[model samples]
Target chain A: MTDPNKPASVARRTISTPLILTAILIALALIALASGSRPFNQTVIDIFLRVILVVGLYIFIGNSGVMSFGHIGFTCLGGYAAAWLTMPPMMKQTLLPGLPNWLMQLQLPYWAGALIAALWAALWAAVFGKILLRLSGIAASIATFAMLAMINTIYSNWESVTAATSSVVGIPIVRTIWPYLIAAILSVFIAWAHAISRAGLALRAARDEPTAAAASGVDITKERLIAFVISGAVMGMGGALFAHSIGVVTPDTFYLTLTFTSLSMLVVGGIGSLSGAVLGVVILSSLIQALRWLEAGVTVGSTTFGIPNGLQEITLGIVMIVILAFRPSGIMANSELIWPRARPEKPDEMSGTTPTQQGVTK
Target chain B: MQTLFDALSLGSLYALGALGIALIFGVMRLVNFAHGDVISFSVFALLWPSTDAVALVFAGDLPWFLLIPFVLLMGAGLSVLCELIIFRRFRGANPATMMIASFALGFVIRYFLLMLFSSRPKSISLLPALSQPVEILGARIPLLQVITIVATIAILFALTAFLKRTRFGLEMRAAAENFTMARMLGVRANRVIMGAFALSGALAAAIGLILASQTGTADIQMGGAVMLMAFIATVIGGLGSLPGAVLAGFLLGAASVVMQTLLPIDARPFRDAFVYGAVILVLIFRPQGLIAAPGTKERV
Candidate 1:
């Protein structure tokens, strides 16, 4: 009962790692802030978006122990909201002919649009999540993916509301470093806060053991609802930043490719940890850009490096397969690396079934 | 009338797609997101040889019968390969992981197909005679629609017979009920699962061929929208219940077509919303799925 030395040793190991990592990250951020070339600026913002996507994704995937195919739907809502609100009235009239008189009359500031967009996405999530949140594992995932497909179809075809054509325009361009930096910081903070909260504990319980959690009176549905809403809000805000960052939105933009790319970042960095989300975003986004360079018909010295024009996707697929095979748990697995505390095993651990899994699957 | 015909034909395709979806879900409990791509993959197979080699069957010179089996085999092979590589290992994973893997697999498959096919839309001409319109009670319907309906019924009939009478079919049904138990009882569950995937793939391929002929073009994105519809059909039909899927498939098809016919021109675009909305309502009322397995703490 009196293992004072061991306790102090464990504390030292846990407390020091985060301080080192944060210091390193801040240094890297400073370098990014003062980077050169157009690609460098784009890279910073790309990391920011990935940060939002990855951390938000982890909340659902890590907490409830399910993958969501429908997170893309919220991203679409976020993009469209920003696109609709920030579109200048005069410019929107020119681009989107015969826009509703009511729509044309309303105007919003850039930040307000971002906030509203986040709220709108969160609101949608609340309605959708109420039904969707309760389903775990594959059922939840399929439903989410279904939502994405259905919403994308609606967005692509609902010409009056979203544009008839796939292409959209009239976003104010703000291609700079601030948005990405702020997004990354906020996203990290959210992840940190989420991991430590009471709801987070119940979600972890649900992830590991639904029956036990249910027995303890943890309302699994409510936990999922909270995660879904908060995650949607974060993704929505990121979309707002992206709309202004990229200065355009398309139906295709928030579809599978975006979903896959975002998911890939989380996969590469690791799935279970906050640092993994941040680190994975940075590493994977840079790698994608690097891969593009390798394939971009370029020559350095007497050597030329270029893959088949369409090989980029194939390469990424290969990497994903390898990762799944070699490290089914992404880099961080489901455990965080910093400010460390005792983490519990997911209730629905893959190797064996609990009473609920047996009950449901049977 | 033309719009109504188009909607009916499209809904018929959705039902066919849904049948394949239900079979896979019923048996494996995997969402099989790749189901739609199997159809897409078959379309390319049917269209490519005809497009690339003018001498190939269905290039307006060769006999149509020779090409039919080729298309069918392509469907069968693609389904088998997908089953072997992806869905096999994923058994017993959280349904969420399985679903994501499927979604990922579907993405990779479509993009890879796109890279191979250069993302162009393709079509197959089954029969020029089948292209001409037939007048039906004030509705001018293409002969292809009639052929599609007939083909769907014929295939379903054949599948039903196969499932009931064949040794392999019995094994498949048994395995679907309980994989571990069936295996312990000496069923070669792997072989049975593969067979289910193969048969389902064939249905999708055949549907893809017939419907692509009607719609006049095909593309990669086509798989996903239809996959969701098939998912609805499967859900409505009941998980692991074959008859349930078929019943819901045909009913949903007819309902969607009727709804589209009644809708205003502008609202016609939103007909899918009505179908999916209806599915959600159905699901709320029947959470176990329309035709659920009757057991507690056990699957069929």
Candidate 2:
């Protein structure tokens, strides 16, 4: 019934999607390794963090058809947890005296702290998702945003514990790129695995056709909550790594700007596809780095010229708008990157055009 | 008594902001995140382009009559321009896409302002006469507070009359209720949306003027807090319901003032956390909001 040149089957994609993404990531890591420039290495690490965060975002938002403005709140929790666990006991004694005696005395390896941070964020996600997953559409989005604002307010004002708005220093920074690279790869695998799981299928079913899926005995709320908790864990891990990537953590760092950045990246990458999430970060991060270089001054012959100080952000905003205007579903339009040689004439079946592009506003 | 006045004045500001946001959401499902940026832009319109600590008051020096309309017109003009340039292309796009686009637009506006007038907060005396205290009944209130409350009520009354008595208002209300149906019934979609933008922008301008007068400073970030609170109000009131939004805005203001007055000193700093917690609880309990407008319910 199918042509020889048709898109690969679901089985082929199951193995191939992650493989292709992993190869791309490895290629990026290899390039960073070859370059050996400190700033460029740092930039790659930043991109890796975004990869983890955006992929984490895709786990819930991609499958559920719900936009959450609060996942970065998990990143905040994970970052603070990393700070509390990894900061030197002597520094904790002076800066965060309000922490419990055991917590104050505890100093953790970055890996252990990251693991605990994941669980910590997961626990809170479960709690919030239980209450929030019942709402649908825009109201749900607002509730999640409220959750983020609450976390921000509490963290910003909890001076004795969080040092208020002041940055908490002494988070052991990991300058090596391996840990972040591994974490980014791990997040992508987790996302791919979840996408193939039964719950993920059910959640996606609910997203595309809520009435039919509900009629077929899908517990929409439970499936959504499951995705919520898993994504929360991924976000938590990303947050801890984010703290380690920088030697300091502040509540402000995880607030609106980061929220919009990750969301924009995910949305721009193609909110519905896993490959889109990974590639979105890579492409946008590279563009941003290039813009920064240009901002610093690009040398052409003997002349050096640079953009205005704030034009990077302005231009980025314009670029995002143009991208969205031209392709509302994003650059990938919700389809993964398959083998170019075996391109499907009818498009890939599993993650074809998302339900969003089909004109289902709700 | 002073507490009540404070609550009312604050409530009036939120009400105006909610009204502005509600107007646009009613026409299109878009939640116009740039409304706050427009507020900031309107205030900055009064100042010359400079990054200095001292604000070079330009249009701000005009008589109060001209100054007020000038700021309002700036807000309206900017808002309409955004609708034409950016949002017009996004007609019938998914809500998430539109929301992100609006946010991106706001980012561009905020950064543009940052380029023109650095991140530093600039202080300017706006309508200095409004600073005087007037004794009303037993409590002395700032004249501006009384004016704010009265002006809000007048605006509400006029808006109600327009919506009820005029052809344009009727068309707008119909579009808000159901855009497709209204269009089929001969209402022009772009016209209604543009009108909504203009009115929303003017309300943002009004809030800008009031905020500038109250704070005596124009900071790039000044509109952010008010915008967030007003956004919450718009949702709490119900997305498409005008009266509901105004009512919810006033209620939110009262709750905020009451909490600030009643919370213990140590817990005062966490007031926003408590407020946000209450918001979460409200959404959980009334996902349809306190007042659900007709036709907004999803079809099963």
Candidate 3:
């Protein structure tokens, strides 16, 4: 393991990746702010939230090369933690009487609550990842899912504390897109930072050539755990903002549908690239919104036409299948979106170098 | 006696579901998430599409002999069609991509059903005669329960015989064991894979029929819980092992029933938490599963 700081190549590689990511975030934020309509603003907020969640997913699934079905468990935890911290004291006393005196009485501002939520979610991720990361491949996937099921079951049935299956209301709503925009930008930077770190390079190496990487002294488990915890924290923050957006939190909100939707965005974009994660959310979210508008009916000169309800989902599914069938590695195919270079190089070379290690040797 | 009967009945459903999942997984490493939707689709096929709470029985009105075969064929046809249209293109994709594709396909099927049936649970009295209780040794059980168990065993034995005695079965087994080698050996890859899909589809239909008869309702989500249990069974039994899947399915079903019956009344709602906890423990201890199939080891 060479020092990341010693190489000029590593510094150049690190700068470009984050620069590209920050540029994209700025473009999205500008568009969100430029849009005047409340509905459009809300839509942007949703997309930004999704971007955070998917980017969080990329930290682990991308680098570690493991598909997790359980990251939603962290989201659930974050949502609840935010709810507990931000909900009105009176309402908490009535709705969730089982909370300890401090939690029952405490009422924090949204930013503070969200920060606490992220830490709370990350703490649990560390514990669960410690146990589950030992198993690799499909077995790890199932274990994560089981963890999600466990979280869902307890949240759904713990009536006195979590309001069981019922929605917990009275959390302060933040309709302004700026907070979400900032959070989304922060999340992307965090993801970029992790992806450029020495740990990220080692994790990717382990994912691609586990036996070789292990023989070379990479601690695969530790690398995976680090990615998992970082991803978990990002997901938690996304979940907290999600609660603020909707002003309500239910266990079901953070369950299978959310999990699959985020996973699909990540895969459709290019599961292996940070640029893919951002673009995937932007593209898919736009497509869904467009379809939804069509479902609401579109006027064509003389008459109005509309797709029947439910066709949107079917269309989305077909689109996903077609995309996967055509480009199985995803839209980006493990390559970052880079500015056009003066000299063209081999595709393998571009994709092979870690985003952080791109020019270190040169 | 009652408790044993209860466990067996539940186990029979799970075993059947696991067998369907295992068969497909053996041939292709796909975990076919759409299987639950296929079960829902089969039951919905019996009724004329309607939004009413009371189902308008269409093919369901036919004699049991005709109705059963028709439903089975529908399931098999749809399953085969999915393979041809969707799974065929994903044959060479990574397992994660294929799994997501299958999940997307399931979402399509579910929403399609939702559009037709309006998401309401529809009641249909199929094989109402099976609803009666009869003496089984010292334990009285619903005729449907007894039929479910017996039918499961019969299917298992028949499938075992088919896999052992037939040329097609031998090809499928060989393909499952080592697809590339089997293909090189001149087993027609398409035919063997199609056969697995067809059989898996028919089994889904069987579970659908049994569920429709016992529960007396055809809800869009009826198959979800069963499909999830079957999926877990497939994993814990051994990813590509047929007998392992069936065994694990029964074990899981038995665990669920026993937990339900034995847990304190106040703790009853948390029964699933305990079951999932047990699942985590099992996975931690036996990551390769209770029965590790040959050549399925993780590369690292």
Whole-model Cα lDDT per candidate? 0.69, 0.90, 0.89
Q: Per TM-score, what order, best first?
A: 3, 2, 1
Tens-digit lDDT track for model 3 on A1-362?
A: 34555545544544566567767777877886787788888998899999999999999999899999999899999999999999999999989999999999999999999999999999999999999999898889988988999999999999989999999998899998888888988998898778767788888888877877787778999999999999999999998999999999999999989999999999999999988999899989999999999999999998889999999998999899899899998898788776556116444555424533433211
Q: How close is candidate 1 to the true structure, as a TM-score?
A: 0.85
Kindly report the fnat of each predicted structure, to 2 decimals.
0.11, 0.76, 0.80
The worst-scoring run of ten residues by lDDT in candidate 2 chain A lies at A353-362
Q: Enumerate the chain B TM-scores of all models.
A: 0.87, 0.98, 0.98
Segments in model 1 whose C-alpha atoms lie over 4 Å from true places = A1-35, A96-109, A131-146, A157-161, A264-284, A300-303, A339-362, B1-8, B47-62, B86-93, B135-139, B294-300
What is each model's TM-score for chain A?
Answer: 0.84, 0.93, 0.94
Model 2 alpha-carbon miss at residue A35, Å: 1.1
Docking class of 3: high
- Give all TM-scores, in the order shown: 0.85, 0.96, 0.97
Residue pairs in steric clash, candidate 3?
A9-A359, A9-A360
* The candidate that achieves the highest TM-score relative to the unseen native structure: 3
- CAPRI class assigned to model 2: high
Q: Write the per-residue lDDT of candidate 1 for residues B22-121, one digit (tens) a residue.
A: 6777567777777877888876775443323221333323466866677678888999998788777676654434555666666677767776666656
Which CAPRI level is candidate 1? acceptable
